[model samples]
Target: MPVKYQQETAQITWEAAQALIEAVLKEGAAQKIAFSIAVMDAGGHLRAFGRADEAAFLTAEIACDKAWTACFFGQPTHIWNSLVQESHMAPLASHPRLMAVGGGYPIFYQGRLIGGLGVSGGTYEQDQEAAVKALSFTGFDKL
Candidate 1:
């Protein structure tokens, strides 16, 4: 028997991403409210994605950035949004890759950070809801 040496890279599967998208769509969200959903690996690199028909070009990029920000910062992007509101922290806007916006959330499994999700192209609340739902549908249900 020959032993094979292959390095395995951590990743989220496409089925998981699709499940998330279906869940979000089933929530009565309209097609006109297109969404750019992004998923990032544990290292904050893009793993998978989906963009609705009406989603804007910027939507995808922003969504990815939000996911990366959440995963890399190890906290909900909403926290960064909130912190930016403080007079003392306004300068964080200048921080490279720091997005003071909603729609970004971390995905955790077994109490470990495994990935992140970001949704765009809807109202802030809607975007947040979709992102959370996506995480839940992906089997990180408690996220």
Candidate 2:
């Protein structure tokens, strides 16, 4: 007898992505800051995005790259930045599509990696704050 095998994967749903983006936008508005937010699926595919008025035009792409980097590494980009700096691996920071910035975070649900969130167009601390705030609303920040 032969057995069948199956594979399963988790992804960030459209509704959740929209909610996260909205929350980030609201946070940015409250801070009187403009931002570009991007959400990417576990496979590093773009799911949703938003850019606040007056945000830098380049932020759109930067936000996406940040999200991709987070999903790719399964960790916050800031952590990667620190690791690179501490290890003196400066060359890794120059890699294309791998931004070790402070605004990118990998999203997890029930111990499973679901997706990534990226926020840009503000200082690193500001962007990290907005991203974490948005993730908190989705109940994914603690993971």
Candidate 3:
């Protein structure tokens, strides 16, 4: 006899990604800041992206890399900044896609890691605030 088995994984749906991006954009506008935002699925693949009209061209790539970095490490990029500052871990800063900044955050749903979100354009603190605000809108903050 043979048996069939399946595995379940959490993922960020396109609708959810769009909503997250919209929330981030609204937060940026409310704060009088413009930013480029990127969303990545659990596999680190780009799911959705948006850039404000006045945002810098470079911010698009930066935001994508930040999202990938957060998903890759399963942790926020800002946390990596502190970790990499230690002499022994300083080399991590040299990685091409590893941005040790505050704009990137891992997304969680129902206690499961689902995706990542990144925002770039304003100050690091502003970027972080926008990302957090978006995540909160998704109700991830309640988890």
Candidate 4:
């Protein structure tokens, strides 16, 4: 069934998204670990998605949430790590639609914020590596 939306949206270009995903997977070759990747627009809306053949289903959703959190907050997920880990902040740690882990990164283009990328189903460092590769693929490595 076709879904309905109250507002219209402009999605990220598929070619750009694909380029980023492929670069990320290539970067993971040395580790031989599969991953699920998600990208979101500057507004925190999902723009693209990809998963390795054997990646877990949940990884995709988590990846999206992670990217969304980073784009929406305009910062890396790890930046919120300390705040969310505090006892008082624990109550909000499991917020319904966001992630506070270290694997998502915002994408910037031409000196402006463009979108973000998220990678999961691998070690945090590996996931971060993948995200970085994706950003590099988009020519936003300086970010």
lDDT: worst 10-residue window of model 1 = 23-32
C-alpha lDDT of all candidate models, in order: 0.76, 0.90, 0.90, 0.78
What does candidate 2's lDDT look like per residue over 48-107, in tens digits? 999998899999998999999988889888887777786578778778999888999998
RMSD of 4: 6.2
Could you give me the TM-score of model 1 versus the true structure?
Answer: 0.79
Q: After TM-score superposition, what is the CA distance of residue 133 in candidate 4 from its true location, in Å? A: 2.3
- TM-score to true structure, per model: 0.79, 0.91, 0.91, 0.82
- Model 1 CA lDDT for position 103: 85
TM-score of model number 4: 0.82
Please identify model 2 stretches exceeding 4 Å from their true place: 1-6, 86-88
lDDT of 4 by residue, 108-143 (tens): 666666777888988777888778766876777465
Q: Write the per-residue lDDT of candidate 1 for residues 28-86, one digit (tens) a residue.
A: 25435788888888888888788876678998888888888888877878888778888
CA error at residue 37 for candidate 3, angstroms: 0.4
Which residue runs of candidate 4 sit more than 4 Å off their true CA positions? Answer: 1-12, 86-91
Q: State the weakest 10-residue window (summed lDDT) of model 2.
A: 81-90
In candidate 1, which residue ranges exceed 4 Å CA deviation? Answer: 1-11, 25-32, 86-89, 141-143
